[model samples]
Target: MGMHVNEVCINCDRAVADHTQKYCPNCGQPTPVHRIDWHFLGHELEHSVLHMDRGILYSLKQLMLRPGPLLRDYIEGRRGNQVKPLLLITMMSAAVVLLNRLITGGGFMDEGFSQTEAMGQALPAEALRFIAAYRSVSAWIESHFAAFTLMLLPIEALVFWLVFKRYSRLNYPEWLVVTTLLTVQTFVIWSVLVLVHRWLPQTQVLAGVLGMIYTAASLMQFFQGRPLGSTLWRTILALAIFSLASSAAVVAAVIAVMWIG
Candidate 1:
């Protein structure tokens, strides 16, 4: 609730009320907290802040569980308990992306490459290869940050549309909400793996492999309730196509950047 000025002021000075004299004669530092504006805005703002926080927590919980019921409920107008999907997903993804950049930028070059041996008759060549690989990985990641996410999300919608083409299905926007749940899950994996990699000094290959598995499992989670064999088959095939499609899109992004720059 809002604070108030006291009625007990002496009105010590005609031009300046006792509360506004050298200091707040009422509270001793400044004028007392003005009650009018606070009474008008404070309670409403406080309620809104609490409501938004509750929505965020609910959204996060559902997002962590792939193919979670939240997306369906949210998209279907049962929106009483959660934040909008795009806002919540955007905040999570942005936080992860920032963490990745910080880790990658912290003396990232040396820890990322391997050395060559005598039988590896090209120490110089191998070093160059390592550098190129490292740069490509970083470039690809930074390139994909936000602009790429917004771009690829719709592509995912199209991919799922084709996969579920025959089912008693939802509309394009519904499929998008479904796909976003999976893609947002990837950022969670990326954020965790990157943090662990920074703290533990693991091999990049180990980091990459674990990241891939997490990504795959997150996607597979949505296909639950189908036949086990069929789910596995479709998941694998869909993953393959999605990867190819994503890669092509990434390549296109690279080419376009190169052309423009």
Candidate 2:
């Protein structure tokens, strides 16, 4: 349906020769006057949260319930009615961090340090020193974890690309989008485990196991039409590669920090 054009195109400030024209000829922006009126505000409010086809709530529901199909659809150019992957992941990451802060009373770093200290002689002296430095800067890391996630996404996507390149049709950028969605889903699962830790003993272990399982299952589902055995084995290998890369990155960062210190 075309927008009801008024006197001028609010977006381009161009005079409309045809009042029935839905877009401005000069700039091609939609001609709807997005003014602050009760009717406009009400319409926006209603569609923002309750629209059945799109928005954050709808995205979240789709991601949680049918991630493989949602991602496949988005990757195949059916994305007009869906939330962008980056926006969805960023919002999810922020929500996870905020919820963790509330649940832990902002002492997450302290808890982390205590856990590291409990490791005792298992950690080398240099590693211990690194942990001390990390503890001091842990708050900064936690606050900027969303940015960290974004930075690491390409690496994760690289793992996927390498593992599935021979059989898959997706390019690196599409794989990156898939990785972003997967990462957000993992974080959401972790948030749930953290929220229910009191009732569920060993929730950390459970979360880790569940995360691996979900990753494998999601890979198989997303790579539909491939042989089941091929998908499963490739997913497992990709996950192992990603884990090693992540650990190596951490070790390199710590070594660099210790050297600089």
Candidate 3:
């Protein structure tokens, strides 16, 4: 059965070209703009949270199965079906944060750390002091994991664009979008690792290792026809650059704080 529509576009006041049209010709709003109600809210909730045909689950599956081609397609203007990259990352980060909280028994710190004290008693004097001094910042990061993770996107995108500028047609903004998608992938992987950590605490570094591999593989596949070895090396180099730059930034921040104090 066809959806009942209004005589005029409820959004744009434009005449409905056809009563059978599902959306307005002028603004693309639904022909019948239903008022907010329990049924409407319930339907919206279902679509946003549990819809599998198209949305987070679908986007995640595509990202996992063919991340390279998916990114390529999205960058090339085929994004009608996928979730917005930033929104996906935000949602994934929220999910990861929730899982981490659940696993940590509602604590801000990770598995082994005490809720009252972020650092252990056996740590060196300097290390313990540093942790104590930055306890608030650490707690903020634990709470706003998504925002904290996104703070690195600009640098990540910058490095990505610089490294692959000559090889790809994508510009800086496009690279940012690509990085956002990859970060969402990272959140998904991190969530899994959080669960795995519950079982085997020894695999602390596995998330980083797997994230790097997935990123490298995605890049290699995205830039098809490039030699895998060359692409892999370049990806590793980009990661190395990001790591060095971020480490330097942290060191500089600490030094500046110490000097100020």
Write candidate 2's Cα lDDT for 80-170 as tens digits: 7777788878887787677666774553335435767899889998778988666645665677878877878899999989989998888
| lDDT of all predictions | 0.58, 0.76, 0.77
* Candidate 3, lDDT over the whole model: 0.77
Question: Which residue pairs of candidate 3 clash?
Answer: none
Answer with 1 or 3, whichever has the higher TM-score: 3
Model 3, span 173-236: residue lDDT tens: 9999998988787777877877866675533356667788899999998989989888888889
lDDT of 3 at 200: 56
Quote each prediction's TM-score: 0.60, 0.83, 0.83
Q: What is the lDDT of residue 183 in candidate 1?
A: 65
Q: Write the per-residue lDDT of candidate 1 for residues 1-261, one digit (tens) a residue.
A: 323444333233223354444555544543433455667577655554345445555456566753435555666687776666677567666766677567765422245344432335456764555445545654666555566677778887777677666642667888787667666666665667668764666433454455446445544554446555654455456556777898786556555554454
Top lDDT hit: 3
How many clashing pairs per prediction, in order?
0, 0, 0
